[model samples]
Target: MLNYKQKKNQPLKGNRFLISVTVLGSSGPIRFVVNEEDLVGAVIQTVLKSYAREGRFPALGSNLNDFLLYCPISETEALSPWDNIGSVGVRNFMLCRKPQTETAIDVEKSPSVSRKATGSWKTWFNNALTLKISSH
Candidate 1:
């Protein structure tokens, strides 16, 4: 009974594990422990806090919604904010700012100049390729 009581008094930390999150454009990754059941969005917030606390460089602002988290293996798709970190089953993650959306005016301008841009691009590419092939 005494052993059981002593065990009960100890903190339960089974669901927690250390994870390393690499902030894009930062010099190094941030290592911290987190609960497996914690949501991805929550994890990002925690990572940001830790980064700022440590005074890491490139001063990322404090906007949780401005960032996205990804597993290195599945980089094409960011992990959903609603998903649990444990669901990914990976200890390493990458955090990057959400890409800024292009404005409608930019899209409209592209179509008018696309033909000229394509011609220049093709010419530049062909010349570069030719030089490389000729050197071999």
Candidate 2:
């Protein structure tokens, strides 16, 4: 029988990988490219830099503390609100990683005015109906 650790360390041939990244702050997934041998740190840097180039900055936990990277092979599995990753890999493979979440996102929300005093009816609209009369 194959040992668990032995089986886990099995070598892999040159294979293209499926890289999926989930950015915490932005609330979504991310993408990356690597030859597998590259350290997980490199990929994370690549992701963080990509967003930084766009003028958005998020905290990479690994930078400040021992943030462990966990790569879930199955996307269907449920993850918590704070389960970020910085896992490792070897050989040729695809990577599914999360982008660094932007702490301050520029949300494009239009200025909303309070219509609380619009009588008993819902009459909060931009264009108002007008009635015209010819005083002949």
Candidate 3:
């Protein structure tokens, strides 16, 4: 059991952690001192503020809610806005802008073929070769 004074001073003793925020295609990452209990949303807001202070444009826009924090190591997992930074067990992550519907359509219209379709074609060719060899 802790007393009131101890509890009040708990957060003052090494409660903050240093983390890096990198915008994709940007010059470099910026370091920030953030409270361990701060949520992902708060960290993002801090990042936006820092960018603004540095005169970086397109840092945030009307669709600010679409941005997400993604851990490169665990590509499939994304940090939730409500989750605390310390709780996630990661000190670094990339701030990625979620692709809008219109952007995705533009990507599809490009000349490059989809990887999934190419992969299926490769599999079909391999299976056909295997069948031919087996028949012979």
Candidate 4:
């Protein structure tokens, strides 16, 4: 990843690189040739425009700021708008809508029950076989 020092020395124009961006829930990753000096915000705008053309996203009325760009491998970190694309490295990244507070709560609750049920069945089956063998 390019750091602040490298970004400082880079020119704002004439440098372009291709990167893959996967829009969460979309068909697949889209390849974009972006200028090295382009801000993250501008890059997102370009992505949104392409999605709009493809009818993958709604009209421009939607707030672009509500979406975030994340490195898929390190999803917890979001790239800042002030940072240029080159600074983040030219690689595959993810675009997702920021989760709402209510939806976030629901997401946390649904998986544990399924896991518990699966474990419980395995434990019960093993105990039953153990008891049958002991009695025999």
Best by lDDT: 1
Q: In model 3, which runs have C-alpha deviations exceeding 4 angstroms? A: 1-14, 57-59, 102-136
Please give the TM-score that candidate 3 achieves against the real structure. 0.60
Q: Give the RMSD in angstroms, all C-alphas superposed, for model 3.
A: 13.3
Least accurate 10 contiguous residues by lDDT in model 1: 1-10
Tens-digit lDDT string for candidate 1 (70-92): 88778468898888888899999
lDDT for predicted candidate 2 compared with the true structure: 0.38
Evaluate all candidate structures by whole-model CA lDDT and list the values in order: 0.77, 0.38, 0.65, 0.67
Q: What is the lDDT of residue 17 in candidate 1?
A: 93
List ranges where model 2 is wrong by over 4 Å: 1-13, 57-66, 73-136
lDDT of 4 by residue, 8-124 (tens): 585567578888877765766678898787778777776777878777743433456777787755547788877788887657777776654445566588856433222222244
What's model 1's lDDT at 3?
13
* Model 1 vs truth, CA RMSD: 11.4
- Model 1 alpha-carbon drift over 4 Å, by segment: 1-14, 106-136
lDDT (0-100) at residue 59 of candidate 3?
56
How many residue pairs clash in each candidate at the backbone level? 0, 12, 0, 0
**For candidate 2, which ten residues in a row score worst on lDDT?**
118-127
lDDT of 1 at 35: 71
